[model samples]
Target: MPIAFDTTGWQQHDRATWFNPGNGDQVTLSYFDLVPDLPASLDDLPKLRHDLAVVVGEVGCLIEAHVVRLGDVPALLQVVKVPLPNQPSGQVFLGSFTVPKADSSAVLKLQAAERGMTGMREAVLVAQLGFENWVMPHPYAPEVQGRLPFHAGDDPRFDPQFADHPLSRLRAWAHHVVRTARVDPRFAALPPFRPATQPPAAQPPAAQAPAAQAPAPQAAADTGAADTSADVTGPTSPADFTAPPTPTPPADFTPPGESPAAPEPEPAAPEPSNPAAPPGPAVGSTLTTVVPGLPIGGYLPLWVGEQCTFWRMSDPEAVLDKLGLGALARTPLTDRRFRDLVALDASSATITLLDRYRAEDGSTGGSVVRLTRVSGQEAHQALTTDTLLDAFRRLGRISLAAAERGEHVTLEPGTHNGDLAEPYVLLAVEEHEGRPVATARTAPPPPPDTPMWQGTAAVTAPATRESVEAGGLLAMYAMNTWGEHPLRLCLTFGPR
Candidate 1:
């Protein structure tokens, strides 16, 4: 007998989902952990480990019986497994339950029994990860009549519901969807909806237009003026407010292509913003100077057309808790409204958040973010390492997730964790002495000769900055790390 979640015993099955991309089948168990009912203490550690192995093994459920040290600590362990499937096999991928930080099958099943939806978190779009996406404790809903679970919806890209439906209509209604003919019966239909946390279904695409949209559409719009004629009872039309006058098309409306006179000459663009802007070097300012091998700050006014940036603050909440500056953090970001580039900076030592404003100004004044900078007189402080590492992890998880899905990636300083697509195929914060130590980063790897994919940088949100005299060295460290990658192939310092 074999453990239920353990892939070792199942007959290897070829899958159409896993073979589509050039990158062939490979198993990856993102999460495998025990949910101890007993206290995890040093005195009871050995007994806990043995009991886990015995009970799990008796049911053919243990992946491997092993214990790992947490630096000098002894209670924690990172188990090992002989591959069978990357994820536990089941009817449909119930993304909600099968992910990192969550407990193993026994734990999930217990929790699911207690809660109708499994109450599992961290579910993601494993589109590129394959049928491993479907691995679970049982083949989908264990109580269902069919073996597989049913999600409710069609692939919007291949279907028109996501596009043709009005924003108001889509949000108010649900998609009509059914299971694949081969799908198991117990599973009900799947919903075409994404996690409630993702950008709303009707979100307009980035680059849809420059920021500052003509305000969002309003409900109960103003109706056109009524006729006030024999059958009418409402106010007269605004057009009728004045006489029903018909203005001439133009003083000189000409027939098609009759050689209309040319318009007068147009004015030239204004001179460059900074007259003394750096010269000789092709890059902008020392801060704005972006060498192919340099960090983002090497360039100024981070652009949207090509270049990008990311940054963050120390503990943004600490400031709010101490000084009551929560309102400052809540202020919305505007400059990067077009959603092209992400800006990370600290308003003060206390609070930090990402600002999604326009990259370029569509009207007078700077980008919307400039107006919405996160600052309060009471919250003066610098950015910190948490902010920088957060930015890095965000880029790794999400920016790459898009790359994995062949979708676009957004690199912003303030984006949340678990929001990324999957640029970072693997990222873990190395722990020591039962505590998180340093972070480890790994990617699918770019081909040799083009190290462009590898970027390591340290950004000091304004909170990270102590003074102009110090000159945001923490940020410089991140930029330099990102720009300066070893020419050597295959990682020398990854996954440790």
Candidate 2:
């Protein structure tokens, strides 16, 4: 077989001899599967047309990927990159032996898409535009899925500049992946794997939303929810509340040595006023794409912070194969990004994003503000449950733009009191400190009818009054902004 290591730095490629480079030529069902593309619905697409331009908008490759085994246990040798027809380039990525033997390719694709979803917002929803042209769904299909503008085939050359293009972002994403693999003991000890295995059973796919063969009819209850799909506020949006009388609690509520001296004081260390409430369990959810026309991936990992945001990507099938669905899909609420931002907050420099703005310059000249810690009582009200994603997404967008622009930042750039008006949901605010903590999660699953997927955002905690109020609006805007790719797929700088 044409041999080489894939992105994950593991043995990869089909076991078939056609995978061999020694053979002059070979043909097999290996090529039967068409490169994937976005589908509105199977019934909606009576014929397969390979028009990435029609499928997605602007396309930029993934820049980097940080892969970790989804579960505690691991197996199999998985490859994570595209193989050219020539020499091999062993890229380090993550995959599991446990992935069902059946149609592993589709699972691998899903797993790769998931990896993209974890660290960066753009990692999910792959764009079809400016992509290369490959063969159609079934080379002889009545309609073709068409080809990407160019083939990444071996010996093919692209402008060196494209190496840095988002279209080719993973060129380096694999670098760290290999570094990670060398240390991953499971990788070092895998038994020689035969990529060829028994095809998967007829079990329903985890990433594919609906049962295969036929669509499950929606229940009448589903119809009611469908009408209110735009409510956006979630289940808690409707509730009853009344103002409560407030009074000073006992002196025990005060810290030692800080309580007011009383002629006859009730002396005691301040007791905890309130303990944190348990966050709700995973709830039924609905997700949408940030970039319109982008093909949905298998998994979504959300990262949120005071000013940083990321979504780490992994292949769901690989994760499932190695870790099982429950393991990789833990979909942890607090990801590394959130924890790092929390750590950064300890020494964070407050930047007034509103500073240096001139009304003439189209920005309000804002004031100075400090970053403050959120109190237990204030966490919910400040970071409100529904809107956490807005803040994180806005930050994620700005962070990327900042890197692209190579802009250095010091203190919070906002005027001492100026606010950063971004397109996101605000979660928490320390007005005294001028710090806002926002949280958001994402779920990018395959389509309900087909094995296609995208994303859903979940938030924890609350923001200041303003942040909470704007959460709904932010969610709506997010849906619209990323709803579609604005252009044709695969716009090559030159010719195809």
Candidate 3:
């Protein structure tokens, strides 16, 4: 007998991977099972009802798993009218799992078991009900059902060839039913469903109007109030506020037993000196070249302030590299008239190389090398007075020893000139009384049109043995190159 249930609200609830026996690929089935809370009367009817829904699709992806009532009637009204035996709701499992493509029977059995159906009979009933009244029912022709091979014994089994048989194909087809239903307008207007897992929205407290306040009581007037103006007089004139005059002391009056203080002594006049010249280098100050033969040619003082020392170097690459500028030496010199400016910020030991270009207007432009702190410190320490002097002395000894060998002392090209030079001249200024007086050699002006090296010259005569015996040793140096090159390397030490 055909089931008497209505198919109105019966939604398709087939697993996404339902198998097609004919092609051996998973297929989409279309049919809805009765929802859990649907009228129990329809549960046993063996047919879809107008109001029934099922949790369809994969378990995690289940959709439309809601409890709906028949027609527009309230659930309570339907329950009161319909006689449905109270029975535990039947489970209608929905979802697909992996299966061998070659076997059609196994696929069907697995699908049925997943749907909570028992035995072959229950599975067959579900397939039939899902196919009935579907808009696009599987196995369109009724004759296809007869072609499917079915085992006759109580135990449902099929031959290996059964997959190719018409009955097997129809069974697979029956499981795939596509049905479309009109969505009720009322459902669209309903509020969206919020899952129970989420906490309820907090409601804002209602705004309350402020209570009206009563007017304050009025103060009673006093019958007799005093008039404060009667006690106050008119403002006084400025002349009436004069202070008493200070008393004057007699000419000969002095404090008892204290003799008159002696008049302050006048300050002595300073002794006269030559006004034509500026006060010469603090009398006892001495100027000495710490590292002589410091080739200053092709170099310009870019900056020389208390905290900053900058020099533009135009020396050969080999020379600059030796002077703690190996990195700058490696960089290609693109400009025709470019010089590397070595800048030292006293606070930081890093020596920054600024590639300066001499423009046609004699102005300069350049970029500074970005050096790390460690590299800067290393470079700065390499150029310290102590380090350079040590290297200078060692090189000088080597040159003198070679000369003593009776061989021509040909200094190596690109070698520092100070390496083969004489010992640097050290000068000491004699101290007059407690103050030390400074003495410096003034280089005579170079011949006209000649580029004169403007720097302090060393004293021609070394200090006498008596001067050496003097307490103060004003300066020390490793070598001197006063008149050798067309440049003078002058080092001014002391408080300056």
Candidate 4:
């Protein structure tokens, strides 16, 4: 609505008003009239990339980002990739340019899904570059793991050879459009967006200095409020862990293959305290503030039903959502089969229970449903068996052969690992209408080397709607190891 460009050589679709090239590639032009804090200039692209990183962290990786111009107007361009679910070799690529003014912005996007192996070009390119293998280490910081490295077709190093690749095509088109595009006069005349700056807090008189001031800095450090730079590992302390924020286009979009300049480092934060207490959001309270961190699971709102209840934010809900309760919200929890059905592995008399809703209904939109163990003494009492808790418990045990295969196996509550460290259980809930409702709880940090997205490491803090809206929730993804594809699920919450 805010910009115009040629639509040559393209068709149209219901949702894609721009154009399609007959192939799977699509181009769309749209605008958000009011996107708070969207910068009007490209100077902020470096800072904005960190914010954009949070959104793209889940399900994809940013291949290239740049600050450029469109018809004399500053703009941002970006290229990203999202791996297709259940298709290890398939990928969805997006190339876009974002132009922002004041509190609004316009976006021009080109998207294409490639179903073939993504790195074929890399094999040849690697040999030409004198590399032994094409699988190079990712260029991001060490904390940013699990994301696949830049594929050859998307990687700029091979752009000369892969000129017909989606990313390359998009770049050529973006440059042409930027040179000829026209913006609505009214939109261009709007006041430019300015970043908000916080004033220093007023200090109390020396005669009345607060006695507890010493702990304030420690608290800030523990919550990871001291550093917003990229180098800070996600969730330095448990208090900072949160659900992944919803993905959104940032104010600036750059060309594929161009990396944003790293921002100046912030002062180092003080070391966080290693508290043995569990880490999670405060549930059932009206408190709006929570520490921001990576998303370990999906977000769910509190629910209250005649037969069941739910807490505002909890990792357990995310766990259940991944196991299929999320899609079955319309189904009555009172169903007996959902409450008590169990499968026995006769080979070892082991027990297993699949997410019957997913099994019987074939819904959930391809979300990976793996049996997540709800360990700890409190898990049993917090979750009611009549509400499908037991069914989820045995689902993990159905794969005892995984342990024999040397895969990491889910352990039951009260069980110890080879190192004898008890798995900390982070769960809590309340009961209403005689139905059990679980809430969030705290737990000690997982082992330093416990990779994210693996078993228990995937369970961090619960996210709430308010947290996401306030920019306290970061969208971070870990691989979903329990499935053939690397898929992650986002839990949602709402009142029924």
Q: What's the lDDT for all of these models?
A: 0.21, 0.22, 0.23, 0.37
Model 3 lDDT per residue over 1-496, tens place: 0001112122212311223343332322111111112222312222111222111111111111112332221111110001011211112212221111110100111121111211223223322322111111111121211111111211114423344332343333332311111112222222222223334344335323225322211111111122212111111221221111111211112111112233445579889975452122233444221121232322322223211222333233333333321122111112221112344432332234433335698755432222223232333434544434333332333222322332111111111222322323223343356543322222232222221112334222112221221101111221222243212232211111
Estimate the TM-score for candidate 1.
0.18
Name the lDDT value of residue 167 in candidate 4.
60
Q: Report how far residue 260 has shifted in candidate 4, in Å.
A: 24
RMSD of 2: 28.6
Q: Write the per-residue lDDT of candidate 1 for residues 428-469, one digit (tens) a residue.
A: 233356633222223323333222222322111111001111
lDDT of 1 at 15: 13
The per-prediction CA RMSD against the true structure, in angstroms, equals: 29.2, 28.6, 46.8, 24.3
Candidate 2 residues lying further than 4 Å off, grouped into runs, are 2-8, 11-29, 33-51, 55-111, 114-169, 172-387, 390-496
| Predicted candidate 1, C-alpha RMSD | 29.2
lDDT of 3 at 277: 25
Note the clash tally of each candidate. Answer: 59, 110, 17, 23
Q: Which stretches in model 4 have alpha-carbon errors above 4 Å? A: 14-16, 36-41, 116-119, 126-143, 151-153, 198-496
